[model samples]
Target: MAIFLTGVTGYIGSYLAAELLEQHGESLNLLVRAEDSQEAQRRLWRSLQLHFGFPVFHEHLSARIRIFCGDLTSPRFGLNDEKYDLLVSSTDSVLHCAASLNRKSEKSCLNVNLRGTLEVIQLARRAHDAHGLRRFSEVSTVAVAGQRRNEQVTEDSAIDWDRSDYDPYARTKKFGEHLVRELLPDVPRTIFRPSIVLGDSRRPETTQFDMVRAFVFLGGLPVLPFRPDDCVDIVPVDYVADAIVTLHQSPRPKYEIYHLSSGVNSESFRELTAALAEARGKMKPLFWPELEAPFRAIVERLSRRRDNLGYTASRLEVFLPYLVWNTVFDNTRVVAELRRAPAPFSSYCFSLFRYAKENRFRYPYREWPEIATLPSTARDSEYSESARHVSAGEPAK
Candidate 1:
């Protein structure tokens, strides 16, 4: 069966596209947004090369895939009548993985996550009517559980939208899930909610450094507001992509929801910091209460310093909601279906940090020289030592 996939340039989508092509070569239609078909193909090729570490895939890419350049928020994915009809008639499965991850702006999140989702659903409906559509996989986020501190968020957990103020992205995803349920009630649909996707477990590669990678940077801070035992559910991008594809390929029920997370194997803040510190050969950061006046004072003072610590501390404040919460995602459904356990974050945290540091935490940008310069201070002593050791042609610690 042919598959029509979105977000071929995104973090998970890039890896997912490679996997789909490897498993179902020449039967995949990648819906990418670009100036034209050539640009889309180029972008896809570059992404595959950068993320998958294989430039040889370019030779076979054209023959194995059809690239469609258009916007997801537009009607029929911004495709013309003939092209839209052709796409609907040719594909048997729809994998909608494209969405705006803007956490700060509600409008932007709603535009892509909610409205864009609606458009994908409409496309699914057309595909079902025009041709026999087998599966419709919507990639959602476990954050849809939204601000449920210290709660066990199961696959069936109800979104508590009234109790707490969720981040814009989470709220938008929740709305998207509801829309799918409302519109595609009878369609063959599956919602995969993945939590905190990190880098590849076997390789030191990541498409973007967002929330999960932010935590690695946070390790440099002297003090952070987190409980040592606060659970942080993080899964690798490879695992998430593989799980989604496996579930999509397998015949299943009419509608299913799977929490693709590390689940019980998720590490705590202390464990995460320890692993990062070991990787860097530095001291682990101290945990301070969220409202501690002295900690806040130190953060405010450091925020003014022109160093990596100050910058990371300021950025950490922006994602404090994620740090402070202790939510455990239940992934029993996924484990049961996949018949395997996810690789623990501890196994790959070191490789992730090493890659981030070696690549200057900015892969394509390579602006490490500017951010790696640290000011001399008592609090930054460990970082200074690590840097000095590395500069002296010695392994850190």
Candidate 2:
């Protein structure tokens, strides 16, 4: 058996590829885009091998792994004709994890998110189902639920278009979902919708766009308007990888989509700031209008010198969005699935934060513990009750 994985060079793909090498008796044909196929393939091998910190990374098993240099937008992954056919036939599953995650570029997002997904689905249908091509697992986003203000956006929800249809990226993801649902009605499809993926789980080593890290970083300084209840759905990268792998191990549902979020533990803006602050030993609890007065003055004074001030001001880039915004991911489906097969919640839960602080991969603070012991203040906080009471689906009191 072979697993054809796209975006093998990416964060999630790297972890997934390593797991595949460890768990299944299958080779991985990773779709890579590079200037030269031969050199590119070798580079990817070295990367995946070095990243496998465990002694388990089988160095001699290089024969089982192969790499194909190709662009997702190109015909059959832009491979030469023979390689294309070989790829189409040799794999038992295609994990379509490649995509343009640029939040700013709508057109690019649509091209990769919508059209790219359609292409993956089409190619999979061409494979010999009799030969055991079991599935096409798509990496979607919880954003597809869009602006369903307070609607319990379940896997069964009809993918509310009005909310999803706005952002080009969301529109494309929703479109991708539509395409998969329209497939042969026989082809097994699994959609995993993960919200904001955060730091690496086992260690703080991270390559994720963790806005939470930014907010946490900002927390130490005098920023104002920081509330305790604002929150967002931040799941550790390992949990995201594990959930995707978990969804695969379970019996394929007739049709299924799992929301790969931190589930109900979704942090509010304040709670998030508090967590990072608590991790750093400087969690703020009340309004500080006076603090902002001097802070803005310092910034305004600094803004004058383009070279010096601009350089210093960029320091605030990580914390710019700390004041507001919360994206609560309803993971009812994902939670039930997790409970059925519990892996230590500690692996991805608050322990990950401890790993970050200890290694200095994130917040430059004292280690809460060798394994993070969520501080009593943080542990006792009523943020969870507040996060749930204000759950996105329920009516406000």
**Residues 1-397 of candidate 2: C-alpha lDDT, one tens digit per residue:** 5777887777778777766776666677777777554345334544464355312332422346655767777767677768777777777777888887654478898778877776677677777454756777888887777654333356667387554343566667878888887874676778988776766656645544244344334444545544445455667666677777767655664448887776556655555555555655765556454465466566556545677334344434312321233445667676666663223333343445555445444333222112211222221101222122222323223
| Number of backbone-clashing residue pairs for each candidate, in the order shown | 0, 9
Residue 23 in candidate 1, Cα distance off native in Å: 2.7
Deviation of model 2 at 203, angstroms: 1.6
Q: List the residue pairs that clash in candidate 1.
A: none
Model 1 Cα lDDT, one tens digit per residue, 1-397: 4688888888898878877767655367778787665456457666676544322343344245666667878877788887777777778888889988877678888889988888888888888887667888899998788777786788876477585545788888988888988888777788999988878887887767765446666666777666788888889888898889988887774338999897777889888888778877888888876545565566667757778777765655446666567787888888877788788888888887777877766766222233223223312101123334333434434
- Model 2 residue pairs with clashes: 150-392, 150-393, 228-270, 230-268, 230-269, 230-270, 231-267, 231-268, 231-269
Score each candidate by Cα lDDT. Answer: 0.73, 0.59
RMSD of 2: 14.8
lDDT of 2: 0.59
Q: What's model 1's lDDT at 46?
A: 61
